[model samples]
Target: MRRTGPTTVTPVKDTGPPGRGLLYGLGRACARHPWRVIGVWLLVLLAAVAADRAWGGSYADDFDLSGTPSRTGSDLLNAHGAAGSRGVAAQIVVRSDAGPLSAHRDTLTAAGQRLTALPDVISVAAPLDTAGAVTDDGRTGYYTVRFRENPAQFEKSYVGRVDAAVRALRADDVTVEYGGPLGQLARPAAADRASEAIGIGTAVLVLLLGFGSVAAAGFPLLTAVIGLLAGLSVLGLLASRYAFAAASPTLATMMGLGVGLDYSLFLVTRHRKLLHSAEGPVEATARTVATSGRAVLVAALTVTAALAGLFASGVDFIGMLGVAAGTTVLVGALAALTLTPALLGLAGRRIDRWHVRTPVDEPDDSGDIWHRWAATVRRRPWTFLLLGLLGLGVLGAPAAALRLGHVDAGASPVSYTERRAYDLVADGFGPGADGPLTVVVTLDKDHRTTGAQRDALARALRDALTATPGVAAATPPKATEDGALLVSTVTPDTGPQARATTALVHRLEDDVLPGVLSEEGATGYLTGTTAAQQDFRDILADRLPVVVGVVVAAAFVLLLAVFRSPLVALKAAVLNLLSITASFGVVVAVFQWGWGSRLFGIDETVPVESYVPMMMFAIVFGLSMDYEIFLLSRVRETWLETRDNHRSVAVGLAGTARVITCAALIMTSVFLAFLLSTSVVIKMLALGLGVSVVLDATVVRLLLVPAAMYLLDEANWWIPRWLDRLLPRLDPEGSRGRAESTGAAVPAGRVTR
Candidate 1:
């Protein structure tokens, strides 16, 4: 980018005096008007509850790229009153020692007929019959049913109904097992409910442990609740404008709660520490706002920029997530700056009611492990670099084999009406019965789809797709007045079958299919669960680099502006990167690589959805930076007076370390709490993020950063002379380049409210 201006530094002005004035202001505010703050929040909560009832649901379809296939295909289905179809089928399986289909064909046929009559049933394809139904062993038999409409939507509604109907057919003489997308979707909601409960409880426990005070822990949670409510309320309105989906809100809820809690924790902990020195609560609160508040602002901006980068992928569904997540972070940051300080002013010393008693009157002020870490790194920068590089390389190794798959939100579960319908189809037929790929062929200009082209297209598709690693078969192409389309059967096996096979299908569509038909004057677009999933992956890949670049570049500039010393800014940027990377490394190892997939209830075999990495990056980066800014701002504060780099870093570390550690522990627990979710995706994400935050706080921030910075010494404060003259002064009274606005004593009345 472009060079902006030179950095400027100003002499530090002490704001640490005026002791009782600071403490009494907060006490007076609390002693005078506590209920006003409570009343405002209560009103907001009521409004939120109303909004939730009015506009909370009905936005789930926003994620359905299912309808995004060539609008022509959508229109075709629609014209036939099937336009909005989900393009999936249901499978049901029944086992009986009643001999063979010839023996009990009547009971089987009756079951199939009853299913065909279900409201969502488009049509039931013929029974698998003896020819198709029997497994190699006479012990098992399969039957099939074709759906009237898309199996995806069908599962969302009718699968469970069909499953119950089929089970009613069960007697002491027979046994049944159901499998299919529908069956998966209809699985009990218990897992999801359990996951959510566990996640919340875990987060609370972590917060309690981190703050060592229920009040401190409670503040973050309360702030998070407000932020979540506000985010959802605003998203509800936006949902109508952009067709936002239910998944976005669900994901956003966790993200908003986690980030909101963490951001506030950073500020609250720092402010509390500053107050421990006997600064009036109002002054401490304002200083915290001026310093940590700036960090939160800059951090939120970086996160929003990163999330918005997802828009480059050209997939509306993923794009919606980017927007929703970005919005939540922005709103949370705003709440942190405004509501957090206001509440702190009101709570006053009571805010410390839950604070663990400390033997020392003032906060601890001694160099500990971080000091030793800094000394070692300062003495051995090269070794640290080498180790970091090697670790990143290892963590990234899985990228090569990462598979991309889409599990139908509705189909992946094993409860409800839809899943049962799916099992019925699978038992009666085959696993690929639920959602098969639909390939649409459009004739090239001046070249109609002739019989030769049609025949060749069908043959080429079969040749390329049939018997392909994961494909069950490729059926013949069918022609309508508009075009010719073919359906491919994909039967996923256990483990990562859905993800791996889906990835293979997209490769076929983008590479194999185009080559196969290059001479046929017909181009094809793949539309189905597999293709849509692949498209989403492509979108994430496209957007990730842009998002990372934006976040890094913006953060660098912001840091430089705040610190004045390009060296400090560079250190900030580099340390932040290491922290975030290490966090992601842990997430990938544990969640993606299946190191502990069973414990976390994740499918190690399943390639994580493409968007998950980007989501993790956005969230983790912001949180990591929260600590970075909080701790470093304090360091910069000390450096201004001490003028000794080592002393500055040491004092700063001791001053902020305990609070940062506590905040991180709470954040980690909160994120890990998502491990309780029944949704595998949620579990994976929550566990990954939680583990990463914990790692960042301890390994990267506590140990690595100090060592690296200590080695740099005075070099960490270097700023080019010309740039120094040109850059605007960031902090006129505190650190030379603090980006926060100058603090002025608020009028007594303003401070009172």
Candidate 2:
């Protein structure tokens, strides 16, 4: 079936050869005990589900600032009874259309009484009880219901009870809305079942088209889902030990599902090809595991290590997110390694029995379309390289203008109680009322400081804060019970999400507070939800580069070890960075610049969520390695046989491009399907991940990488001889099998695959 080409293409000589050891043994052993392996996997899935229901932790956006100034200040105040230790509060903005809020006093009181009696609520302060809680219009006001435990600490049904308790406040003439963390908890749960169905459906369609067999299509989906569900359960347990963000699980799901399927797909693709060789099912399964499974393992390890490197950033939340996502990927790989072989064993030679059509013919020889494309590139490396660079440059240009900040509730969907609360609060008070800064000033416990000096400093601080450039108002300083601390509320002229608001926080902390407090031996800290979020943004942005450096270095070392070529490792790192830049640019354009933001349910333009870029970098970098390793493994495998880089690149591109393209399509579909999530944050993650996979698979893998290697020629595989000895070799393609493959060039009955 081999076609004559512009040039001859060298085959792998030894590919998926049964002589490959270790992984082959694992696969054969599992295949021989198919029922036992299947049973064990089933038990694992069951245990994971049961464990989550019994002892799983809660999910919330609990960004704990352990050593940050705001956290330190807040902790001191809470310890000294300056900050309310009454626990978390649900802020309710109330509006009356018929008359002033006074007209609805009885209803408000009843609502408060019911809330106070509700489970976990520690106290309730109705607007009428708290002076200044009502606005000047007298028609709008707010109240607080303090709960003993944070909302996530409660069961899901608890939200229903709170909803019922506040029903009286939502009459024809009155309305109630939830704000702050409470608002986050109050938002309706997004059902991802639809998205999951769509992803599976798309995967099935793609599998059928490629494999042309119904039975062959289902195993990948089944194993992926099994691994994913179990992995998710594990993440829930991790949430108990670590405070991961609310979006953590969704992010994990997105990664787990994509990788889980792709890993399984590779194994099954190899197994099916082996089966067609008329080899016994057990032998074919073993060879498939030895060959394709080794690639999956290396790819998985590389990804896990890269994600773990996120810890280098020194941000626990970011690092934990990486851990969360990495866990799923690890588990997914485990499933593929053990479970896929068992499934293959169960199916035997009948994998094609439930046929939809003959499987698509994939040409692995040098004369196929991808081979010709690679040949064309090899002949004109500069043109292909420049074209790829042009495309990537155009896509990534928007990243230069990325703006990172908190996404306020004002950006939440209108259907969310949080958004309604944000709007009502802004209208009733000022735009900044929803995110007031709490200035906590603590004087040293000295007689002079506690006396006239303390009074003088507090006065000066109040004067300076109110006169500050962005300040709209500042409340008079109120002393705590010990009189050791003074707390004041500072409102900015702009909303909490505005750049001006962040500038104001920095201005006060750096200049205004220091100027007054230093004279009195006092320390002033900006301690409030708004200020804490600003701290989060600043910390993450500052550490972005550290994370990038860690991930890139980790990848370079990994590639260098696997391929034993410094240039190959460096090319992969650079190409991965290009993929990330393009993806980040797309996210910036859609979410920050609002260039069709509405398509993703964003109502208005907003700053890119502060942590999004860092998270994206770590994830995209790891994922890009999957394909990088896949292609490079084959190229290296071929090079070891012939020591010819040009023929190896061409043959590798022709051989793997079909599977990689199909795999990219499947992964992209999974990521894109998550766009159905109501959370704007999740949608942003979906688009970024999806776009990255597409661009990386096409522009980078199909164009830039091959072109670069073509131009580099034999230099691509040259490693400094001294360093080569120091580097450990991890041949993902089984070197032992190469001796067996030399006899036939390629296994009989193997087509373009």
Candidate 3:
């Protein structure tokens, strides 16, 4: 590697604040032993990949709903041997063009037998034997197949066997489709290869334009790819140990790429600035790490902290998703701190060697467009602040009407087997049949009712359910072998995830079942896939407030400690909250109101996924803080020197605005690319996150922040002396340099004038 400038002979000491001290030491070590660090990272990557390939488990949708009625009912059913295991239940639909399916009884029987023989299949109930399996038309029919395990936990090869078994029934006049969990397995993989490609391509283009150097552009992308790979490998390993949602890795990838690229970009930008002063590569790298690297570290921790706060949601699966995403962020930060510096050392001056054109020097900010904009904002603070607030308020208005619920297979495209199966079942047996609610009755041990009396009571309960307002039908009760449990399947008139269905579930839990069963010395639990989903939604809604409180409080405290100014931290929290709400509003409008839904491939209005708001708040809040820190750090440095609030605000905004804008664009592009995802949840997340970044960067960071600081004047930096003394010094900008001294404050009034 070609050396950029003279090497520093003096040894660097760890005498700064703890964060900077740690980063400086790490930088020196990596710079001195670049080869060793690189080699070690390579080995780790390999080991992670190898281990994942050998032992890693695939993502699944299994959730631990312990203490919920669903769990109780599932356990009771399993113990009573009413169903196969507590595994997944699927549907195999067959439609014959020739005539009624009953005419092809022999073929249907053989198909059912073949399905039962498939790997992991616990049992298959033939349409010929099962009631409600065939439509009134008699041309369409379905068989219920039960698996020994969740289909998500089954090997990919098992899906092929299922397809083959179903295909065997596909005659020239017949069409077969798989539904339920099996259909979910057959659905196109949710991973968006195109989105990943487009995101990286866009990042490369943006980086090149910003840096004017191909090598500088490539470095961030390369580091992010490595970090993402490592993160996902670990995620795969984690999935083996614990059940993670199928979207976990995808979520991790999105977060990992955004943070990884942005972190490296910060460090690289600082390095370039130091290089202009003729600092040697090693010294410059150390200083960059000490300064921008510290900022990266704090920002990463803030994000991780916010994500970890999801644990407060009281849903293990949602919390695990947060953990999965946080794991990637942690890995990305580690890479930015260590792997990036090592690579910088290896590249030396060659970091810019691959430029398509001569790399432009970092520009002076005094007369820049951002500085002029800041000057404009300072001139009319109230006007800008009002405009910013109004825009955010309008955008966030729709959030007032936000409805949280799960999306059903009916929302998926008809091309998907699960969706087709769902449609067939709906068309034949009514939408309610797609998600029947099982009423599980467990009798009191001391009940005086004999088996015959219990039977009469079950029949009465069934009649009552059938007479219920929203119930379409109620099956005759079936007792467990031990006679301790009785289950009656109740089909609602509405589809699962429909508002009416949710209402019916609550009704059964609160009124109908209790009114009928309580007098009989028995308790009824409404449990099934649909009921469990409703319960999950309820849990998310109940816990969302706690999760938001924890995340916001944590962020506020961290910001307060860092800035030593309560006003600054409070302003940040409030602004971030505004941005998040605005983003939520957009999600509600587009997704729930069906406004421009087709632009993102959504065919119908759907309830916002219940967990989306909580997850988005944590993520967007942390990200909004990232830009806040970057902007305010510069502003604080300028304020300390000039003691002129307006000047400091202008200078700070001018200095960091360009980089922050570029970073936000990069992050937004990364998130928006996920719009192509097949999963509605992923699409919702992508749009919400992308919009939040744009609004935060342009509206909040640029307009609101500057205007607020200008209005607050000296108050922006005010902190009680006692509090200042008590708080640890957190210099986001390292101690290597100071802003040029301007004359001390004229009186505060005079300075403002």
Candidate 4:
């Protein structure tokens, strides 16, 4: 049934084709050997649980300055020990309602003594020592506590003690408000726990809502949990070999659950649609496996490939993230292709038992919103195009002023011990006390410096550091050569003072040391958290273009080959850019600008992580494209048969909307689950990504895409008639046994007859 102009439309009914025999066979296998799939996955889950329990938490000093330059930069001060000059620096601001210092003297002394005796306590200085501890107002007092162990090396066990102490102090009517890296890190560990719980719960709720059947809703979540367990087990093994950071589990959980559930959603949605149309459940399940399964494999490969590019970053953490995320996605894909279909077969008709009330005489190709959208886009392509461009430009505006810096982990959400401890450090000790800078001076191999030369070099290094505007002071350089090497320490101003100090460190390295080294034929490597950040930014800027190009190129080829429509493929690529830009804009606003500073409990002054952009690009590109493929695949199926661009877009959108919405919801929930992790970077990444995916599926994919396509009309399908002739046909519409579809209408008795 087809109509030319807009008119009252009758809902089209689908009558699935006879080619469902393959699907039936898959269902039969699952029905006959349900345990086959269950047994294997169960074993995997069990093993993962076992391994996680056996292994401990992860904490690796990938950014330590004494190591290779990758982590040994100024930006990675705390990683190397800057809080102790560069380790975990905590300043506790203890206030009393008992009048003044004289009235609460005993309580303050007792609290101070208790803190000073804590393990790994370097030194605790209180107001009793001098006026340094008392605020200018004289009502508030600060206690400075430096850790003997590098904050990077602070043990979880030690953090627990500090947390207990903070709690116990409340009994004394003393409010313990603290700030620092130690407290920050501790805070998120707890939030991470809570966030994980919320994420898992959200996933379950969404799955049930979308699937509308208890069994169906629970199936994907079950699969995801299994995948998470297995992925974490593998993560544990990796932890054994590398200095994997604590944030890895959060990342693993997110990628595993989000991708795992989304893949299952796609497969199950197709399977159910087929069954509802009279294809035997078995047959429908098989077809879904073959078609959607193929799509899943391709999608997984694309994600893995994008993640793999992180290896080129030459940064260990980024490299580890690439490997870990890639592994989890692969594992999740495997589970989808194998375990999911097997589960469907086992469940048989029960899979579609959760059906919503279907409207009678639903248009086989009539009045679908997607169709209207396509018609509109085809008619007025330029308006939609311009509008899309403008939106992207607006979102990308904030990215221009993004400033990278080391954010205290406690600033994330103050529910963890680390954050409490960190706050204490900041309140008492000082800011910029958590991360420090290292200056490495290496002499020319030809120069064997005598004693006088060593003294001169030390003196020159100290004087140069002192003269630098930002540096608080420069300690004498320790000579270590056959006199070929020397190391010096420079302390920056406290807190805000540290900003100028960090700048001064850079000035010494960039403006001062280069000239000195060049003249002496020696090389100076200024390694600190600040320096490392600069390097990371440089590396990311250089490689981002390559990463974006590779992803776009790969996606274009895949879409082009699949749809046989260059216009369609190009549209997908452009839309992806829009999705990413909007998402990145949101990330920059929340994480970089600290706009909601008090809400997340992070300092507005905290710098954005240097690698956030690169990581976000790889992740957002892959995840966003997943939605792209899911939506476009249906549209392609419709367009191939009818060759009516508007009709095809409508039919495709109608068929896919429910499934895409469900999948997006699940994926967003899983990503937001990272908010449970104890790392600021992890939370920020998760929050940014989660918000973006939701927007992409709903706003970009659903509304704008269809509206624009609707306006385009026949032009949407236009290819240079000449180029169309040269390109080999990719769609299989002409082949027998395949369903015949018009761009607007799929005939009765197709897959979902």
Candidate 5:
């Protein structure tokens, strides 16, 4: 627990030049005082948890669309005291298997009365009180319950009381189910503990196979778990102060675990390699941090940068998701640099203890498959390049048909009460009744019209809306307390996310409302949960291109600066884009095209979740760069020494291939584990990310990169003098220390002919 800087560790024998001095210094400092480093991390985790308890934020589907029609209508309703800012509505669906619901009217009425009496319950309208509440068949009925605030903000006990009151009416012949936001509150928790267990278990198996020692294999998992806990704690604190989506924590955890393990794996692999040549534990740790630790830092920064690029999405909720994920990645990098080395120091030579088999030595190409593959790629680069492009093209084709929208309760599992209620209502009242839009009409304050004129205008507006092509029905207009506002409910003939329904909403706003309200000196706005979700979808679609452009531009600039080669940077950008597109195509095929929906527990095709594409693009783009940098850094190092593209490409591929493959497998396993989640969005993310990693590591990195580099030859290193001067030198491996530590010479015996 000393408070002194790391003293330089001189190798017993000079290898070449000193490498990665900053990272080595930091690692040496942590190694010298392992307990202090571990203790500080523990304190940070505890403090974050405490802060979260005192002032933690809650996750909600709250979206801010200031200029959209939904916002205007919402403002009008709240202005006239007709609706609370956080008002929520729930449906109580009742059906009788043996007889008509009318037979249980008295019981239903009593239950409605009970619901109305519950705390936070604004009112409850029984089936008998509203003409449309009863289905034409007479066996099914529903009641409407409005709440004063969003159910997410309500106390947990409140939902239990409401559940009790609603279930009280259930008889031998009657079935009662809840729907809407209340049903969401009542749904059982879907924990990812099982997913985490699976991911970690798989990682352990992979690590054991790769490292051949129990302690060495376990170290990565231990550091990753601790790092993930710290990241989630910090995310909780951020959520308390800001608006985050319900998916933020899950997404962040996925990223944290994947990167945490990968970063630690890289350093551990390097440490094990250096252990054979270095004089002692101190020098080996220092050299490992100096080289692989620096790569982890650069890779982590690239990921954070890509995530932060989500701000270009222009949606506050989506942007906050970026913040949540980016924060965790940053913490993961810090843990790799500090906590990982400390643990390694503590393990010392015993890291190879508790062996399952003999530990593998540093990667070399002596009769290795990777070396043979590299030689093949070099000999026929054109063939590999064409094959890789053709495969990516086929996989990416489905992306052209991608549709963006929200998934409704109908998509939930049959066991969920919400899904049951959704089915019941759809059978009785038509699919459109499950999602209805509200139209709010407000007269300008300076209007000269009299009260009678206002009434006439309201009637005309209602008739026009009902007559709209896609609108199934429009209720008669009702006036607010101040008489300045008129509200009517409109139901579409199609389901909420259907293209027909979206068309109906737009037509009502753009064609119907403007024409009808012009004569009355009033403006009409469409607002409701359905309307709001549609607006969110539209906004995501519009801003997606901008988000992609920003991310690509930033990553390209970063690569160009670091590699100092325009062709290399451009190749990285193109290959990453191909990987992302292919992954998107897979998502579209499975989720939207219903190709494998049943396998994933999806009942039917749902539009791609609106924010998913943007989220995936930023994440995949950044992550693809990780392997790009890791592999290319070694290539650049070799090319600088040999000045022979063929030799450098072969040597670099042989040295880094095993580590990259192992890292990719570890990440892919972590992402795939989340497929066990019941949440559809989580499933989509898990599949997309997992698939992207597989493609990037195998097809893009192994096949295409070598083929492309071999084809380009000296052109890959060509940089315009002016541009090279403008870009800052970004040697991921320290310039002065690299040669003295790891040395520039390739293993002479292992080099491919």
Candidate 6:
């Protein structure tokens, strides 16, 4: 051992290996055959897109609630022909602003007849004929068009035909709106390309400013776009056989673009730095890939693993979404590991050929702002740590009150027909009219549930529902042909997304249903989109702990394996969770607490979409690890070299801070651009992701992480001897330093002071 100062001690060096690793070999090979690597990627992209176009299965939302009461009730309804004649209805809402809708009876009748004449139409209820279909004021009426299947399953053009079916009622005096999937089809389409362009545009600016070279900045964008397209193509192919949420591609695009930029940006930054002093492009590319590229690989793995853990939610729709995003992340890593080096090789020493300013890499440490920042944290560890905790605690406080459910159409942009329809229905018949819950009772086979007995049971159930504290109205129950089931709709006083609505659902399930039918030899359940959404919310809430535990444990293990330090791994997990908590609070504040909801085009407060937290946790957890690995890898390298905890922390933070900050800026910009989307769900995901990256990069990374590591000192690197021996020695940045110091894998020209 050697001592550099009174308190600084140096440990014996372990120089077990003197050869380049597989990452270097891959990078060297790709760099040596740049054209071939680029060509192969293009071919893969083309084949994936072509095959997906020809053979890919369409994406349909998988709301497969197998064991829930709502699912059972829904299944019974479908089996017994109670869900209209064939399937769920696509509604048409008609309101006469001029006067009572009685004046529009002739128009409504003609529209119903035309709708009834359309193919796949099982039945069309004329507002005048169906009881309670017209509002009390008679100013608003709706036509329920029951089809053989969900209209959402068909092409939007089909809805256009359905729209034509009601053209006669679209007069100046009549305010007509579509509901359900029909309304979704009727809304003006938002261009996903516009959002993508904005993200790419903003990312380019950050890269340009950081790299000071247009060509260098363009490389990351090129690699990222290629990876994103390839990933989306694969997602399309997966969608052919599996049911993915319709938003899967949108989510994929958002993540793929952001993380694709992330992986490529870091690789390019390291490559440029190495190429500046290295003898040849091949040597620089090899070293860059082995060092920073390893960080990218670990990051992608953490992200993919965290995403895979979404399966713990026990929902395929949610899990498949993870798959969709993970595929892009993995592909982006591939591009960084191979395509990035290839592009670097093609550029050679002229990587900054199209320079706006002389390219700048990491600065010498004497005046490094990051070093000053790290020292500041080290000197006042408690102050910085407490400051970080306070900021995160305040930001994350609202998440404690997080409520999960589906965002109703009432929260959508008014430009959407669904929103208009929701508003009109609420204004005419009360808020509950848009989210009516169907009450279903399955009569026991042992009992004679027929004639007066069945009628009496039905009446009792209906009466029970109508008299419930939250219910505004309840329709008379109608029996199926076999008389073994009875069904009715219950209208609650609150909107579907309201907390009161959630409470009402629970009250119905826990009290009214059992009280009315517990001894009547019947099983009752609330069924409908509203009830089903709430059921799904409960399922997610129950399984959230499973997902969080699995993802955290897996991440902890991965960090342990990579760093060979239990405390470091544990700290990473805890810190990542802190960042996620802050992000969750931001989401709850905006979407649930109604704080700045208008900025996202949301007209009303909506529950955090049931799966948003789950998805955000997986994504943020994975992504936060990227910065963790980037900073820690460099710190570990320094610790290995000098064996001084304080110096290593300062040098490591200084070395990597600029790159990490640039990457975070680009990623945050890419994600935030998606807030331009009118879809509330997309906006929620955007804000959560964008906010998480900012907090993680700034408050957590700059303040909390260094401060804690400084306070812990040598303990930060401690692990049980047995545990250390069991863990793999994976030193991504350390080996590069060793290789440079020994001149084993690089020329003398490649080694910089």
Cα-lDDT of candidate 4: 0.63
- lDDT head-to-head 4 vs 6, winner: 6
Error of 6 at 447 (Å): 3.9
Poorly placed runs, candidate 3 (over 4 Å)? 1-20, 83-86, 350-365, 445-448, 725-729, 735-753
The runs of at least 3 residues in candidate 2 whose Cα sits more than 4 Å from the true structure, single-residue gaps closed, are 1-20, 83-86, 276-278, 445-451, 736-753
Please give the distance, in angstroms, between residue 450's alpha carbon in candidate 2 and its true position after superposition.
5.2
Candidate models: Cα lDDT each? 0.59, 0.83, 0.82, 0.63, 0.83, 0.84
Residue 141 lDDT in candidate 5 = 87
Candidate 1 vs candidate 4: the TM-score winner is 1
Comparing 3 and 6 by lDDT, which wins? 6
Worst window of 10 by summed lDDT in candidate 6 = 744-753
Better of 2 and 3 by TM-score: 2
Could you tell me which 10 consecutive residues in candidate 1 have the lowest summed lDDT? Answer: 744-753
Write model 1 residue lDDT over 328-386, tens digit each, in one string.
77777766666677677777877757655431222464546655555566577667766
Tell me the alpha-carbon RMSD of every candidate.
6.9, 4.9, 6.2, 7.7, 6.1, 4.3
lDDT tens string, model 2, 1-753? 342223233444444464657888999998999999989999988998899888888878776788888898788788888645457777878898778999888989998899889977787889988867888988888887778778755666777887788787886468888887778787777678887888888999998987787767788888899999999999988877878878888888888989999899888877877776736999888877887788999999988988898888787878888999998999999999999899989999888888889965446566668888988888888998899999989999999998888988998888888899999989888898888888988878882345676677778888999999999999988778787788898988889888788889999999999987887778888988888899999888888899899889988998888877788899999989988999999999998888988888887888888888888898899999999988888787777666567888987887678778878998999899998888878888899999999999999998899999988876786665567668775667674366445643321111221
Looking at model 2, residue 104 earns an lDDT score of 85
CA shift of 195, model 3, Å: 0.5
How are the candidates ranked when ordered by TM-score, highest leading? 2, 6, 3, 5, 1, 4
The residue ranges of model 6 lying beyond 4 angstroms of the native Cα positions read 1-18, 56-60, 83-85, 98-107, 171-173, 728-731, 734-753
lDDT string for model 3 (632-715, tens) is 876765565555678778877876776787788999999999998888899999999999999999999889999998888767
Error of 2 at 102 (Å): 1.0
**Model 5 poorest ten-residue lDDT run:** 744-753
